[model samples]
Target: EDALYQKLYASLKNRELATKDRTERNSMFARRYPSHAQEESKKQHDHFSLKAAQSDASVEASRLRRQQHFTELASIMKSSNESRINSASERARHHFATVQGEREGKWSNTRQRFDEIRSREQEQRDQIAEMRIIHSNELSFRGTKNSGSISPTSTLRAQTPGSISYFSNNDDETAKTGAVADRLISRILKAANSGKHRRPSEVGSVFESSNCVSSLNTSPSREKPREIDDNATDKTQI
Candidate 1:
């Protein structure tokens, strides 16, 4: 009976020791596996978040660079347009000034030419008036020399040397009749040379009434004919 009691006590003590060892092993496993899994999961989530942030930053920087380039190009175009407009305005102003100066110069020249023409016309009018006055003075100076002042009868008697004493004894009547006969002779000679015809009585009336020889000498005779002398017969005889 003492041996049986000793074996039963030993079995109970072994059972208690085995239960304690099992509880300690389950505690160690829970601490090792669950904490390692939680750390790995946290590391993966942090890496994914860093990559997403880098992509967002790159997209924003590219968009800002494009906006700056467009603004600079627009500013350059505006400056070029302003410069062209200013150059065009300057050219237009210069052209207008040149045209105005030319017009003024032309008007001045025309006015000067008109003044010269008027001066020349006044000088011509003065010259014509001076010529007319000189001609009138010359005509007034020569009016008295052309009128007949000597007596025709005395002039004819003085011109004839010996023919008056043979005509009549009264010298005044002989001078007057000689003057009439001289005038009639001159007129008859002039009419014959000029191809004009006159009556015999018209030529004979200027001579003295008793001078039949003088009347017959002054009048052209109708009964007797004149003979033409031939120069060819006289030259042959010479």
Candidate 2:
């Protein structure tokens, strides 16, 4: 191409040389084509910087997306874990409460049984003492009859001195005697119960007289007062 440009210029000026000096031509070519490689290199550098910036932006976007995803997943996992822990705690509390209730019920039942047994034993003791006093009173009443302080009318029995006989007739005097006997027994029971603390109904339970219709055949006053031996009164209560 340089040779072609030189020939065209020589033809235009009508000058030809077999060995032409190329200094001016070389200088002109150098001036015109100067630093094209450097410009291309600069352009390449700019392109590389642009590509690097784009790659960095893509990488930063991807990293941000990854962080966001991780944050959301972590939040979900944390919420799920907290919920599970709360559920477990609630179940444990319920189980603990159930066990506590059952334990309390068992303890209450056992204590109630113990109290019942203790009450029964105390009632038996009181009954035995009451029987002994009733026996002693009978002996004293018999002594009073023998001393003529009282006369035996309808109370005489074939078996024992203090024993009573049942009246075949339901006369007014016989009914009065039975009524007196009932009142006397009630008074004795009340006296025995006076020193103790109990429900009024429970203390009064013993005063419910024998069934009147069935017992009228053998009145309460007609009940035989036999001699009670030592320790026999306790057995009678039993």
Candidate 3:
């Protein structure tokens, strides 16, 4: 406040004395002397006013010099404060980025670990299930092999016992037919076996058996069908 008042006062005095010179002051003295002829009093007042204006000029010049220093100090302080603020902001941003990156990395690693653990666990479970199935199959196969409840041979016999007996009877009947056919072929054709037919019971039985070729009551050995046909053909040719 005091500085501002002094500056204002100096500005007013400078304006008043800005154009002051010997010629201008003499002109003012001439005009004022004709109006009021107190030469000594006017000269003393003019000298005092000149001295006051010089003092005011010196004070104003000193204040303006200090103003230059004040302006330079204010600019330096402003730049320092701005630089400090910028550096602080940069540090804050860097810290935040680092923290965020670390947090995200930790989360990523944790997720990967969990997934790997789960995959291993799932694989272990599958292996256990496969082992259980293999063990069951092995047990079942061993039981089937060792147990005699349902063997392949027994199953086959059980399924075809009647059919097997029937086939055997049919084979016996074919053999009996063949034997009678042979006897007939020899008798009708007078073959080399006439001595056998000389037995009446054998001759009668041969004729009877020939009529029952489909019968399955033959206890005699089987004869080949080809041999029977050959004998018949020989009788026909004869």
Top candidate, metric TM-score: 2
- Per-candidate TM-scores read 0.29, 0.42, 0.37
lDDT of 2 by residue, 1-238 (tens): 9999998998866544432445565456657877874576588999999999999999999999999999999999999999999999999999999999999999999999999989977886777576556645643443111111222234423235223332322245455555544554556556555544447675345334433334433345655644433433111110
Candidate 1: worst 10 consecutive residues by lDDT? 229-238
- Residue 227, candidate 3: Cα error in Å is 41
Instruction: For residues 1-238, write the lDDT of model 1, one tens digit per residue.
Output: 7888888888887788777787676566657777865676577788877778877887888888888888888888888888988888888888899998999899999989998888866665554454344334423332222222222211122113213211222344444444544454455445545544557676455344435345323233333222212321211000
Residue 163's lDDT within candidate 1 is 30
Model 2 CA lDDT for position 214:
42
User: What ordering of candidates by TM-score runs from best to worst?
Assistant: 2, 3, 1
Q: Predictions ranked by lDDT, top down?
A: 2, 3, 1
Better of 1 and 3 by TM-score: 3
RMSD of each: 30.9, 16.4, 28.5
| lDDT of candidates 1 onward, in order | 0.51, 0.57, 0.52
State the lDDT of candidate 3 residue by residue for 44-84, as single tens digits. Answer: 89999999999999999999999989999999999999999
